[model samples]
Target: MDLREYSVFDIMGPVMIGPSSSHTAGAARLAKIARQIAGDDVKEVQFILYDSFANTYKGHGTDKALVAGIIGIDPDDERLSHSFELAKEQNISFSFVKSDKDASHPNTVRMVIKNKSGDVIEVLGSSIGGGNVVLKEINGMSVEFTGEYETLITKHIDKPGIIAMVTKVLSEHMINIAFMRVYRQLKGDMAIMVIESDQTIPEDVRIRIEHIDGIEKAIVVDSINKA
Candidate 1:
């Protein structure tokens, strides 16, 4: 098997807070995604760890890493060690659960997050050996995207022409779609769309997507090219 050229940081080292990149950095990234999926102010959080993460998280500062992220700390910052006190200051309650079942990846975490509005969302992510992470699922739907690009997430009624409507708007705005994935439990039910693009998605595009006839909710989950 041939190994593709990986990132230089992954090869040498990731200038991060904790000792383990997979547990600490990956856990923090999941928190940033939690903010993206839930909102900035998280009221409650539950992290489910499987495989290696379940056994050694406490020693690696993984728990603190997760708490730091949920409370708005940057993953690379050194303050990740004090995440517990910070989370207490923020009044955000968090819990951890170790899973006995096997996961596709060795370092996987599933989070159940709730926002200030009492809206709860489930996010599944995996730390792929580097400081890099991949968001694998949302709620129960399958999705795959790394936060390296601008991403758009929409929850809509599963029906015809919605894709056309959304993409048309992006096309009009000259946004280049790098990757896209759609997940739905069944036909004619709730659907979720994840579209990663090469440019910053404007607020207008997100609003427009929500306005489409079949769309129920729309939001941009992008971090690239932000001021």
Candidate 2:
């Protein structure tokens, strides 16, 4: 038999401003990551709630938390309660819709965000439980990643040596990769690379990666699970 040790967070959940960890904390984290993927210049956002989230979002303050996150507020921030007003002041429009997805997790929401540049991103994720969340899909591509670590996400053309080039840049910057995954739909098509690093990824490093051949976009997200 294998044994493992659990941290205080595992039992008590994350420190956050919330009535429920799953509904508030986890929802905030998921929305924040979605905004990071879509860029901070988002002009508008649509949150499509599913199952449990659709049924009880307002009561649990999930709607407020989601709005706060997309606009760069932390879960523990006092301002989380007034996220809607903040969004209005920032000129960021948002709407929420109820959706029923078959075979989907109970606490799932899909975010469709459009930036000022007219680029749109669709992100699907779920707050599993206890303030933990997993990103399941980006655009139309299937992906799996947790925003627990400082993450690097890249959109690029799928080709031989592309992975090596990106890794080489990370190695040069002395960034240690804790985990990495690549997702693509078809051969020689567009691909996404998700890298979880043991250290924070600087914005300059992300820019360096973006300038690499075959790379289209690169984004760095700070660890959301950190205390």
Candidate 3:
């Protein structure tokens, strides 16, 4: 193993309320990020659990963790244990269903969330042990990003110069890009750009990026594990 790529926290694990790191802490983080991606007006949520997550969720506290996350509770929050009550109090309905479909990871879940506006979003993610997680898909578009950075997501028309123009705006703001990915379902169609930056992109900068021609939406997810 390349020890250089691992931090002390990777070995020691995160400070969280957990009986199992993958099922509890990681599940919470994954659901929390999914909630963030889906926006705050979420009215209802359905968790389609797969593989190990499906087999052992309730026993391992993954059920509570996932509920806690959808209601904006963090893994380390003391309220994690009572997330179901909190969700009911907040009027956010949720359910968990086990799936027999094959998953890429043992701890995987697909979140189908509906907002009060009736808009729905689907997000797929996995907890890869050690309280670490990765979001793999958004609204059926393939994506890959850990919620460890101040990440920016943009949905826009797939056209020439779009990426360059967006990058130029970030460059002007002196935001260093740690990672960037672009995905489209077909040629000359809608596309999604995922950018993980070393520094937080200011709201003004994000607004400028969104105003660019062909850009539909620019959403930023603040770093969950800020260094």
Q: What TM-score would every model get versus the actual structure?
A: 0.90, 0.96, 0.95
Q: What is the C-alpha lDDT of each candidate?
A: 0.84, 0.91, 0.92
> Candidate order by TM-score, highest to lowest?
2, 3, 1
Per-candidate total of colliding backbone pairs: 0, 0, 0
Winner by TM-score between candidate 2 and candidate 1: 2
Candidate 2 versus the native: TM-score?
0.96
Tens digit of per-residue lDDT, candidate 2, span 1-227:
54868897677855689798899988988999999999888789999999999999999999999999899888888899999999999999999999876526999999999999999999999999888899999997988888989999999999999999999999999999999999999989999999999998888889999999999999987798653
> Which sections of candidate 1 miss by over 4 Å?
1-13, 224-227
Each prediction's RMSD to truth: 2.2, 1.4, 1.4
Q: Provide the lDDT at 169 for model 2.
A: 92
> How many angstroms is residue 102 displaced in model 2 relative to the true structure, after the best TM-score fit?
2.3
Q: lDDT tens digits, residues 1-227, model 1?
A: 75887767557765678687778887887777767777576899999999988999899888898888778777788788998988888888999999999998988888899888898989898888667788888888888888878889899889999999999999999999999888999999999999999899888888988899989888777562231
Once model 1 is optimally superposed onto the true structure by TM-score, how far is the C-alpha of residue 194 displaced, in angstroms?
0.9
Best by TM-score: 2
Kindly give the stretch of ten consecutive residues in candidate 1 with the minimal lDDT sum. 218-227
Per-residue lDDT, model 1, residue 66, is 84
Any runs in candidate 2 off by more than 4 Å, and if so which? Answer: none
